[model samples]
Target: MGHGGQRDPSEYRKITAEVFYDISRRKNGVRPCPGQGFPTDIKIECSKEIRDYPVGTKVRLDVVETDKEGSRPFLYSSYKWEHEVVE
Candidate 1:
């Protein structure tokens, strides 16, 4: 089973061999930590997986790893966070 298929989104700090990022209107981006400043502000509003992130929990999702395409290696931890009951 895949991570999102079998693994529960509430019991682990999900990390994968993947990464994806996109700049808003500029060519460069200053990724702010989900709970930190602009850009990286953790906004899970309207998302179930994200809206579930409890205050203080760290979470990221939908990262696209594209090294074969031609870009360098990088990660964007700007998915969503939720409180997971660590079993």
Candidate 2:
């Protein structure tokens, strides 16, 4: 079961991505999800909170399940940048 009593809800997983551009006042950038399992480029929306991080910084993104039929993983709101990728 998923949210709101929905059956077979989408599963969420966090992935590490790199900041392609500066996330300052422009509020527009891109974070590419690098890996063999999940290779996709997610657009970056710089909120007031995450405007400090610079380019080449690795951030975590909570991605939804992409294997399900007709599922849209890119539509998920994964803008919570807390932990930095050490490696």
Candidate 3:
């Protein structure tokens, strides 16, 4: 599971990807967080910028020791805060 929160939309990087499917669980008992609405899972395929990689070649996904370029994505937090006040 991965989640990211950014203050600026431009802080997010844009990449080219081939979308496979987009699934929305709104009608399937999916509950929305206070600020965020319903959730949707989108599947996509993208090519990594591996040096010397041949075009149209398929490679197995595996873990690497280090990432020189910002290819891999990491999620620092998954919690969403909703404030309620009682008077």
lDDT of 3 by residue, 15-69 (tens): 2221121235221111112222212222222222321233222222211122226
CA lDDT of each prediction against the hidden true structure = 0.32, 0.47, 0.24
lDDT of 1 by residue, 1-87 (tens): 133434344433333111113345322222224333233432222233433434334433333221235754443333343222221
Which ranges in model 2 have alpha carbons more than 4 Å from their true place? 1-10, 22-28, 44-48, 65-75, 78-87
Q: Score candidate 3 by lDDT.
A: 0.24
Using all chains and alpha carbons, the TM-scores for the candidates as numbered come to 0.24, 0.47, 0.17
Per residue, candidate 2 scores C-alpha lDDT tens digits across 1-87 of 123323243454556656555445354354556681454554444343443556666666544533237854442323443445533
**How far is each candidate from the true structure, as Cα RMSD in Å?**
10.4, 6.2, 17.7
Better of 2 and 3 by lDDT: 2
Sequence-dependent TM-score of model 3 = 0.17
Candidate 1 weakest ten by summed lDDT? 13-22
By lDDT, highest first, what's the ranking?
2, 1, 3
lDDT at position 33, candidate 3: 21
> Clashes in model 2: which pairs?
none
Candidate 1 C-alpha error for residue 4, in Å: 15
Task: State the lDDT at 34 in candidate 1.
Answer: 39
